[model samples]
Target chain A: MTEMLRVENLRVEIKEETILDGLNFSLEEGVHVLLGPNGTGKSTLLGTIMGLHKYKVSGKVYFYGEDITDLTPDQRFKKGIFLAYQLPPAVRGVRLKDILKKILNIDPKKDLPVEIYNYLKSLDLDETFLEREINYGFSGGERKKSEILQLLLAKPKLALLDEPDSGVDIDSLKLIGEALRKIAKESNLLIVTHNLKILDYVVPDSVIVLLDGKFVYKDGLEIIHQIEERGYDYVRRLVYAQNLS
Target chain B: MLKTYLKEIRERALKAKDKPAILGPDIDLEPYMRTIEETPIDDLEKLPDEIKENILYSGITPSENDKAGTYFQINHSVVYEKLQEIYKGKLEIMSIQEALEKYEWLENYYSRLIPPDTDKYTAWAEIKPTGGYFIRVFKGQKVEHPVQSCLYIKEGNISQNVHNIIIVEEGAEVFVTTGCLTHLKDQPGIHIGISEFYVKKGGKLYFTMIHNWSEEFHVRPRTAVLVEEGGVFINNYVTLKPVKSIQSYPTVYVRKGAIARLYSIIYGRKDSYIDLGGRLIFEEEDAKGEIVSRIIANDSSKIYSRSEIIGKAKGTKGFLDCRGILLSKSSQIVAVPILDAQHPESELSHEAAIGPINEEEIEYLTTRGFDKDEAMSTITRGFLSLEIPGLPKVAKEQINYAVAQLEKAGL
Candidate 1:
């Protein structure tokens, strides 16, 4: 099997404060979850991998066996890497339909494929929502569903979703999980969320623990149960012991 | 009737060089006046091929069997003028010169909307006004397609002063989409356009003007709309290209139960200075007015946007909104929005905001699949997009397409 993404010795600093400290992460494919407590660098890790230039990153990021450490966000997009922002900025005049067609590389005048409408209906969003400005005055659940809708249309090789399960009701969260499950069938999914509720609807193939910007452990689906039943304290102790060793 | 006003305005034009706060800076027109006098007037037979090219560049080429109506004026002469049989049979459309000669009653409406001595430019236009159209839609009739007018200037060191008058009779509807363009480079020219629109009782008139000028063109456009009881006037104005300097303040007067909406999108490119604004006044009870101005200052350009809404009587509503976006560090945008309600029961509101394009929004677009330039264009297109209700489909699309091309070419 080919490695989809690899991060080697990744260290990130923002405003002279260390965020991600010497983190090493590897994922082959399929749906994976980065479950960690708040204040950890889960979102920061995703942003760095997506080539946000604000953070001072000293490490190498490889995607599909090629070093993509220096690529811009636009370049990464062209190379089939997409990030669903947790709090996407509101584009005052750019409509959701316009950007959706733009991401699909299709003419806005042409009819969007039927599958998109189907996905929208399944997500409980009316087609009229496409004509609205991107994320402007949208509810939290609407924002998440909008992100998921873009992910479905983008069909990227890898999707990094930051906290899709947060700030959403159970129904919207379930819809997002279902949408993620549908997308994971064709592409890779790396979800960053503090909560473990979404896993009930669509379980992850693997789970990684990020604590204090460090990758503490990586295991199969079994680890999700352990982390949920007991707090992250046990994982913190394990990481401390591992570092001491 | 003409002598009394003409004598005073010409003298005012002669003495006018500066000193109007709303008109911004002034330009010396003596040199251009001489060039314009020496040059022969261009008619259809004497027109050069470049005029056709400019017409095509403006995205609408005249056809032999064209529908609705089409009018073109170059410099001080009418080049191509046509009123489709359908429109001509019902409405009266003719050149300003022809209309003046045919109708003696037109003298009343010539400058009623904008007085001759209102500004230096208006005085100049009154003294040496040239090519413009006169349109009157008969009472109780609705015209589907707009009366298309193209005003183009080519030669340098000249002036194109035009006066247009449009009157929609009671219970009638009419629309006009005019394009002012100059393709020449380094040819210093001054253009002053005076437009007056009169909407009678229960009538509606929609006017759209798109200006595309070169870097050396100085433009001064004065416009006014008078709406009677229950009448409506919608004006959409945009400038998508570079210009030396431009100053325009359009006013709309709304009467009892009438409404006026003025929307404008102004773009200033390198070294360009633009002062664009709209003013609305409610003179009678229960009148309504709204104004929206979107200013995009890019590449060291400076833009001044002013929106004012005033209510004179009770039970009136007025709104004014001015928004600006600066695309470059050197560019600047100043927004002045004022709302005044003299009556105790009248309501007036205003909002003004000026900000630069958020870099995070650009990156957000890039992360979605657009390249840097594409992202910039998308953000700009969205920033300037204001949905003007009842705009002509073809005209709206043509203007939008031209704007998109301008954005792709980087302002």
Candidate 2:
């Protein structure tokens, strides 16, 4: 199988502090989860992979075997890579329907009858919400659903969701998991979350443990059970043992 | 007020130039200037009813400075002759003096829409020729197309003070588009253009103004619309480029059951300075007003929008919304919305928002395959959408065109 996304020796230093240190990872066309503590650079790795271009990054990022370490977020987007931020900005006076229409160029009178209705129904959002400004005054769960809605609308090849289940409610979280599961069947999914409650709904094909900016272990879903039982002490011990060996 | 304003004009005229031992009468015609200033007031009593009605319908505000009678002579004589030639048969366009001389009683009907001495420029504008436009739409008159006026600065070093008065009688509809433009470069100039609109009950009047001037020019445009009961007035004022400084706030005074909507968008770039906003005053029941403004500033440019809504009458509803988008670090945008209500039963609301474009949102869009510029442009195209209820198809198309260009330019 071909690698969809590959990160080699990725070192990220933000404000003089190295957050991602010589990280190495790759994912095929399926679901992958980066699970770790809050400060383990899970989000940073996603940012670097998504071409955020803020931090000073050293090393290589390859999308489908092509070097994209220097590609901008926009270029990556055109190449079918997408990121769902944990905290999205509120764009006032811009309606959600208008944005969706502009981005997708969907003819609402003819084509949107079923597609839009099903999309909103899947997220349990009412039609009135479509006319309101984008994420303005939206609840935490609503913002997550909005992100999901964009995902469904844009339909990129790779989706890097930074803590997609962080602030979402249980019901919406389930919808998000289901949506992720549905989307991942056709596209690659890399979800970054500190807690694994979201995994209860949509299990990951592989789990990677990130510790102190480095990947300590890469295994199946059962590794998450190990973290649930042992904690960071076990991961740190493995990192120390590997460094000495 | 006119006397005080004229005294100041005289002082400014004295400082204009000094040719030692001037012998050519200094090109000052105080008597003719005084005739231009006071003749309208004097003719109000002597003119026939028909002529008086014509003058009052002309909508000219007489000179404020009773003293620089000489200043009006030095500045207005040439302006009057040129205006007479430009607007000979199609419509009646004149200065306050000529309107007063020709139709004094008519000039007396509705004069002071914007009070003089609100500022120096306004005060000076009140006295300087009061460049007035007299356009009359007969009852049941349907103008096939809109009429346009261009207040152009033809000379390199010149100050233009043009006042316009438009009246569309009952059962008539008229569309007027006026613009302020200049060709001079690196030269200091002042332009004060004021227009008064009176739409009789059941009359429809649409006014559009496009203002673009150079950096060395100080442009002050004060326009007012008085909509009677059952009248409808739509004013679309756009400022594409104001080089140096601009202070223009077109306002509307709607009576009972009238609808007034003003859509203004101002863009400030480079070192431009813009202090622009608008006002809506509702004085009767069932009257409504909406003011929407969008301002963008880049480089070291500064834009300030002050929109005011005064709801004093019952059943009156007014909404003032201002949005500011600042692009550069040095650029500044200050939007202040003030609402004053005397009637508790009236509905009044004001909202103001200022912030940079969200980087995360842009990142999301960019990751979706747009570049940084494309992301901003996409967001900006979204920003220009305002609630333009009952907008004409052509106006909507023009606004769409402007948005497309802005998006293409990456905001």
TM-score of chain A of each: 0.94, 0.91
What is the C-alpha local distance difference test score of each model?
A: 0.82, 0.68
Clashes of each: 0, 15
| Model 1: residue B31 alpha-carbon error in angstroms | 3.1
Model 2 chain B poorest ten-residue lDDT run: B64-73
iRMS, candidate 2, in Å: value is 2.6
lDDT of 1 by residue, A1-245 (tens): 67899999999998999999999878887788887888888888999989976789998999999999999998998899989999999998899988888888898688777888898998999999988899999999999999999999999999999999889998898899888888888888899887777777666878888998876588888877777788888788877888889
Candidate with top lDDT is 1
- Model 1 is docked with a DockQ of 0.76
C-alpha RMSD over true interface residues, each candidate: 1.0, 2.6
TM-score of every model?
Answer: 0.93, 0.71
Show model 1 residue runs off by greater than 4 Å: A107-109, B1-22, B34-47, B56-60, B64-67, B407-409
* Candidate 1: residue pairs that collide: none
**Residue B119 of model 2: what lDDT?**
48
lDDT of 2 at A225: 72
Fnat (0 to 1) per candidate = 0.80, 0.57
